[model samples]
Target chain A: MKVTLIAGSNREQASSTQLTRYMARLLEEQGFEAEVFSLYEHQLPLYGPGEAYGHEEVLKLSQAVKSAQAVVLTTPEYHSSISGVLKNALDFLNSEYFEGKPVLSASSAGGTVGVSSLGTLQGIVRNLHGLNCPEWISIGSDQRKFTDEGEPADQATELRIRKAVDTFVHLIHRMYG
Target chain B: MKVTLIAGSNREQASSTQLTRYMARLLEEQGFEAEVFSLYEHQLPLYGPGEAYGHEEVLKLSQAVKSAQAVVLTTPEYHSSISGVLKNALDFLNSEYFEGKPVLSASSAGGTVGVSSLGTLQGIVRNLHGLNCPEWISIGSDQRKFTDEGEPADQATELRIRKAVDTFVHLIHRMYG
Candidate 1:
């Protein structure tokens, strides 16, 4: 099973990136092939008709989202919501792209609201007809959640991630099969 | 008086951009120095810690936003909210960046709900400490509502634009002066 993790954190050392990486690893450990597409690496133009008219990068991005079997999005909570880059990427995509897709939306940030943006995003994805996973894994601003090496630091968070991954994998199994 | 219009529409010929340009011209006609910062021209990385550490481009963007006396943001509604690129640019800004600045949020989109995203964006900007003009402008999607040159075609829409600009300028005068 191919699982695409869309990492929305715009930093090299972002907690959101670390969280997405951890999710990818957990999914891989469950015998699923997972790849993360970091928003930082993509040359996304401000999404609009300009880019919609065959911008090579936007085309590649749309194809990536379309081809994914199961999609996982990790975004930071910015001003009580998800970052704009993640939102921009999503804006360029149509509901047809996510129709029947079991998408998992997760968020992490510096404060206590690890998943504050999740509620807003969940509403959006639901509007797009995406089958969002019931349990959203939000890693609240637990500064000690990540190790010095930027890995998940706490055992409890790690275990929680494991359960989220299993739930995601099971959903993919039920939907795609 | 200075009114800097940040055209958030990424499209080469978008109704929102047209409205923004029209608003800028109208402001200039009213004896205010108006400038339009097309999002398509600005090269900002997605907000990240890398930029937070004073990346060159990030510094330039920060300075641009800080120097503006008042800002008019024109965005297209996407999935019942503002576009991601605009949101990303806002995310990159510090809270104090718009702390005491007057802002006018407007939208032009295809759906009847195109203006719906403006309220959400208003909430975000308010959270960021911006003084938003409560009387917002929204153009419902109609190809005929746009001119051959992409300016607003309807007389009523033009009247509305004038009223919005008048309100925005008044708000800036009242708040800043």
Candidate 2:
């Protein structure tokens, strides 16, 4: 299965990207192909109503999500909500791209747990007509805290993330198989 | 009294902008000095966490909101929520500008009334520590449909909008007077 991941932060080399990369590796281990779409790396202009299909970046992201068997979207919480960059990308497409796709949501937090952003994202997924997996990954501070060895400092967060991913993978497998 | 209005749409000459302009006029009539900050005219780059202070657009908007006695935010609903452009602009600043201010939110809908976006916006204002006025302005299609002479087709919407504006101004006067 092919999965598309969205790293929904505008910071350079953000923990949101790192987290998505980690998610991709785990999906790969489970016999899935994955690609990370970094908002920081591919900056789309502010969304324009009735004009997204003409934009290059929107076309690319839309194509990736449309063809994928499942999607994983990761965001850094901003002011108790999903980052505007992520929401902006999502605003460009609608049910056409997301319909019936199993989407797993995760958040790259800023010190605290990203609970509110996850709630808002779930609502958004419902609006997009996507099948939102109930298991959420709110990257608490420990999940992104890196040690001097350049690895996440805590393994407990990893286990939590794995469980969510495994559940999402199981959900996708049930749909396609 | 100063009231800062945000026209939260990226479209050129959007109805969202027009709605804010109308609100500004109403506030001006109520003896409140009003300024409509057009997000469409002043395009902000996607927000970078902890880096907004350096950006010119952010500084301008933050200064405006900080100095204003009250605020009126208008948006176009997208995906059953506030437009990403509006939320993106908001993600740049926090309670430093909005603290203790009375914020009245309005939305210029695509076709239906933007009730969900208004609810979401109220939650965001609360997160920013602003006092959210309970009365909301959910601009229905009648509010934006223009006549041959460029006036709104339905005067009923104007009356509703005026009521909302009156309620907001009353709340502000209670605070400042």
Candidate 3:
């Protein structure tokens, strides 16, 4: 019923966020309640002795994560992996937040190899005891932008993104129902 | 003959720094030139279209990375992976910087599971084409600190740190030689 979306990019308004927002909108159109949590806004201290266990930010983040029915995480590939900001947030709530949640991962990259970041994240998530959607929503930079009229100027990419969103929505519905 | 150690933790001074500083000290004692760079202070911007290809900070960071004959990267584990700050910095540099250089990775975590960050980092460095030493250094939190004055508060941890340092230094010498 309630789905939480995490925008994993550190940039104020990244393509990953825009794409995820678009997907969230589609999910809403299909009758699911959704909320977006921008990871960049969470000011988490570096995990350490005094900070790792009971840091205020950690506790607050964990509480938010505990209440979610399903989570959608969006990230941009950095050095062939997920951003530290996202990983740090996930690290804080490990077995507690991720135990039985169905997580859908989506990624945006600058090249045809947008899937690299997705693959790396999948590997990391699999090892963390997460149940991930078998098909990930991956967008490369070939046709990264849209016009002011909200139309994708590049037809090929428009089709790809449409398919990605449809598949993701299907996966979420299957997982939740 | 100059080696630059990148301390990846966000803390002003961290165990990774302590361990990296120890390596620098050992290298200096053995008569090799070295310097340590605290990556947290670099404040690198997240990679974007214009930012990733070339930026002032990216140029400066890459220059530092390129100038070094060998590099020692130290990080704290977060979500079974390396920190984004360090990965961001590495992503700024092209593969030429790491093509044939020797790299040593060390990590300090709060528990036995700290090995995740180390393993993740090793995978990244290898993917970047850095010649990594097979033996990596991993220190759990229970063994890294002391009460007040310099003392071996935990003999077992002291021994592990010493062994880790020794292996790290030996590999550096071999790589540099």
Candidate 4:
């Protein structure tokens, strides 16, 4: 199965994106193909509510979500909520793009716990009518920094991510396997 | 005192903008100069973190927020949260612009109640370190429509808005008087 992973940060060197890349490696090692969508690389215009400027990036983004059997989103908790870049990307997409798909959410939190933004992210999933896996990954502020290959250096953090990956993949099996 | 009002919607005919304009009238009638920041009229690029491409619109948006004695934000709840356009505009700003300023938030709701988004918006104000007035406004889907001159047709809705305006203006007086 193929999964579309969104690295939902706008910073040039975002730990959230790095975490997404790490998760991509974990998913790939499990024999699933993973595509990482980075906002820094694939920029989008500010969305007009009803107007479609027909931007190329938006088309690619929509196509990625449309074709994926499942989707993953990684974000950094900014000011107790999800980053605006991620929120904007979600704005450009419609319910049909994510409908019935198994979507997983993760966070590289700035604070002690990233649960603040997760609730809002789940709300976004419900808004898109996507089936969001209950188990989500949250790398606290101190645990977010990763190596060059996007591997977490801390063992416990790595274990949490691995278990999250397993839970998500198992859920995907029930839906699409 | 000057109050900066943000019409936090991008729709061509957004009632949130209308509500903002209406509040402007109310603020003006009570002897406060009001300016409304609108996404539909003055657009901004998607924000890139730590990058100062220095768009003229961003400068103006920053200046408006920086100079206001008080600020009011009117957002339409999209997906049970604030609109992406509003969030993007806010992303371009920092706490220095809004610190200690009086910020009152309101919503043009898609669903029955907009409290769902207000809590998050208050979180945003807190992030900016602004003194958000405890009273907020929410126009339900039914009462969101307004006249071209920015007047609400519903009497009870108008009264509620007027009361919110009074509460906000009262708070502003306590802060700046």
Pairs that collide in candidate 2 are: none
Q: What tens-digit string does per-residue lDDT give for candidate 4 at B1-177?
A: 899999889897888888998999999999998999998888888888655438888888998888899999889998888998899999988888876676888898877669777767876875675655646788886787686667898888999999878977876775565
User: Which one wins on lDDT?
Assistant: 4
Sort by TM-score, top down from the best: 4, 2, 1, 3
TM-score for all models, in order of appearance: 0.49, 0.50, 0.47, 0.51
Candidate 4: which docking quality band?
Answer: incorrect
Clashes in model 3: which pairs?
Answer: none
Off by over 4 Å in 4: A1-177, B49-53
In candidate 4, which residue pairs clash? none
| Cα lDDT, model 2, residue B80 | 89
Q: Give the chain A TM-score for each candidate.
A: 0.91, 0.93, 0.83, 0.95
Q: Please compute and give the TM-score of the first chain of candidate 3 against the native first chain.
A: 0.83
CA lDDT, candidate 2, residue A92: 85
Better of 1 and 4 by TM-score: 4
lDDT of 3 by residue, B137-173 (tens): 7777665665354333677766765665565565445
lDDT by residue (A50-153, candidate 1, tens digit) is 53637776787777777787889889888988999899888888788776576787888667665568867765775565655645677776642687665678
lDDT of 4 by residue, A1-177 (tens): 899999889887898898898889989998899999999999888888655548899988988888898999889899888999999999988788876677788988877678778767866875675765646788886787687766887888999899888877876675664
